[model samples]
Target: MRFPCPDLDPPYYAVIFTSRRTPGDGGYDAMGERMEALAREQPGYLGIESVRAADGHGITVSYWRDLESIRAWRQHEEHRAAQARGRADWYEAYEVRVCRVEREHGFDRQRA
Candidate 1:
């Protein structure tokens, strides 16, 4: 798998998002792509990884530099709009959890 961000050390933050997608797109795909692009421009965005199962359950983990960055992203007008759209149309159910990374370890086989 390709990693979105490389060389990230400890003491970062991650927003863990898990959700069940609704039956139809309802503009979700467009908005999701837009959000990814917009997020990449944000001040503290590190990277994001996301995947959806054939059954429609999905998980997205977004890395950030700090809690302040997360808060700013949550309060961003466009992001807020997306949240409303998610509640009103796109998701069957969803949950978000934020956690701090105190330590991490990984190796890339391709690099090896």
Candidate 2:
């Protein structure tokens, strides 16, 4: 998706998901879109950014209002199912990192 969500305001949480795909799409693209849509419907979901390289490595960092929000999203039934499918069908390997964003700053020349 986009590189990053704008003006996240700090004191939030980010779930960083890094992975390597197995091979082909194998329905992963559709499910990924579905999960993203579902995440947007969650109570504390801020936004999500994702990208992939030609070598099959990818990263998706999802912003949330708090740890509780992140936990809820993780245990969401559909999201849990997607995680299962990712392990069984889509991803060769993956890692998830959760961090508190205490502060943030950036530049956007395009906005200037």
Candidate 3:
């Protein structure tokens, strides 16, 4: 399901994390849920959406108010540990991109 987010104006930040997973779960699912819960408790957090394919390819996009919030999340102790675990066992490969969202437009049939 597409996660709903509050309507935010221009100039926010988005972190797009794309990854290819390893063979099995390796505790990744639990850790991911924990991390998402933690992120929601943090300052400047906006929203997030995630999807995974049967082939173990996935993408998670998280929105933030600013870069400093992203840095803080990166430095969080539990998140650091999860990162280490991901590097060692969970993900085969991953890429992270941070972008400034200058503009956005979408259509929702329900809204219409």
Candidate 4:
């Protein structure tokens, strides 16, 4: 689902992760894809947007239903293992930001 942020309020939590990549890690792409797939299967996963720069900085914004779901995802063993690998090999650095989105509005072109 694609979420277009319009006149949105702030109360819903947003998980924003920004990372800097390491060299020669072809596996990171595959691992990222797998992680995204897995996340969609998890509870409270709303949606995600992933962007990458030519300089190797990447940002992923994942939307969740609540704080508990975010906490659950953070403590998930599989995610923990991947995060460790990211810190050890794939990513040079990362920052996680959690914020609340109070309200949102969007119109689906397809719906019209």
Query: By lDDT, who's the top model here?
Result: 2
Q: List candidate 2 stretches off by more than 4 Å.
A: none
Q: What tens digits encode model 2's per-residue C-alpha lDDT throughout 1-112?
A: 5786878978999999999999899999999989989999999999989999989999999999999999999999999999999999999999999999999988899987
Candidate 3 whole-model C-alpha lDDT, 0 to 1? 0.92
Question: After best superposition, candidate 3 residue 99: deviation in angstroms?
Answer: 0.3
**lDDT at 49, model 2:** 91
Each model's lDDT comes to: 0.91, 0.93, 0.92, 0.82
- The candidate that wins on TM-score is 2
Supply every candidate's count of residue pairs whose N, Cα or C atoms clash at under 3 angstroms: 0, 0, 0, 9
Tens-digit lDDT track for model 3 on 41-63? 99999999899999999999999
> 1 or 4, which is superior by lDDT?
1
Per-model TM-score versus the true fold = 0.93, 0.97, 0.94, 0.82
lDDT of 2 at 66: 94
RMSD of 1: 1.5
Give the per-residue Cα lDDT of candidate 4 at 73.
Answer: 93
TM-score, predicted candidate 1 vs. hidden true structure: 0.93
Worst 10 residues of 3 by lDDT: 1-10
**1-112 per-residue lDDT for model 4 (tens digits):** 2334333234667899998888776688788888889888889887787888888898888888799999999998888999988988988889999988887666788777
lDDT of 1 by residue, 44-77 (tens): 9999988888888999999999999999999999
